[model samples]
Target: MSLENELKSLIIAELKLVDIKAEDINDDQPLFGEGLGLDSLDAVELVVLLQRHYKIETKDLEQSKEVFASVRSLANYIRAQQDRK
Candidate 1:
């Protein structure tokens, strides 16, 4: 599957999101607020998820904000980080 798909699945599973499937996630949809309804704690879990799954360490809070913007954004960030290695 595409990285975005993978990340979507990861997000759903990690967060134990009920009534949602990976396909339900829109690539450009916000993961917080009105989109996925994730909160600050969810953001922290997402950062840890990235590190655990992709070896990506988002140490900067502001940077995390951008990186976690959406599935597409997170997928792009992960791909870019992997490319740098």
Candidate 2:
């Protein structure tokens, strides 16, 4: 599967988003606010999800904002990090 789709699955599974499915998520859809209705706590869970699954560590707050913007962005970030390794 595509990284974006994989990320969507991971996000939904890790965050326990019982109301949503991977197919329901859009690549460019916002993860927070009105998009997926994610909150700060979900952001924290996302961080843990990245580390646990992708071995990624997002330490910069500003960068995290961009990295966590959407499923596409998260997939890009994961790919970039993997490329570095």
Candidate 3:
């Protein structure tokens, strides 16, 4: 599957979201606040999702800021990591 579709699936499955599709998410849309209505718990879940999906280890808070900026960033990171492996 494409990165977009894979991410959509991963987000829905990992976050236990309902009635959402890939098209529902904007690439640069904020994952928190009014964008996705995600909270700290959702952020934690997203961390787990990144670990499982990207196979990348992110420890620093600053690094996470860039990596998990949005779905596009996350997917790009995942693709890069997957390529490395």
Output the number of the lDDT-best candidate: 1
Please report how far candidate 1 places residue 19 from its true position, in Å: 0.2
Scored against the true structure, residue 70 in model 3 reaches a CA lDDT of 81
- What candidate 3 gets wrong by more than 4 Å, as runs, is none
Global lDDT scores for all candidate models: 0.93, 0.91, 0.80
Q: What is candidate 2's CA lDDT for residue 28? A: 92
In model 3, pairs of residues that clash are none
Q: Per-prediction count of colliding residue pairs?
A: 0, 0, 0
| Error in Å for residue 15 of model 1 | 0.3
Worst 10 residues of 3 by lDDT: 49-58
Give me the runs in candidate 1 sitting further than 4 Å from their true place. Answer: none
- In candidate 2, stretches whose alpha carbon ends up further than 4 angstroms from where it belongs are none
Q: Any idea how many clashes model 3 has?
A: 0
| Clash pairs detected, candidate 2 | none
Deviation from native of the Cα of residue 64 in model 1, angstroms: 1.2
The residue-by-residue lDDT of candidate 1 on 1-85, one tens digit each, is 9999999999999999999999989999999999999998899899899889999999887888898999999999999999999
Tens-digit lDDT string for candidate 3 (4-84): 677877887888888888788888887778777778898788888777766677788897878777888888877887888
Worst 10 residues of 2 by lDDT: 10-19
Give per-residue CA lDDT, model 2, range 23-60, as digits (tens): 99999999999999999999999999999988899999
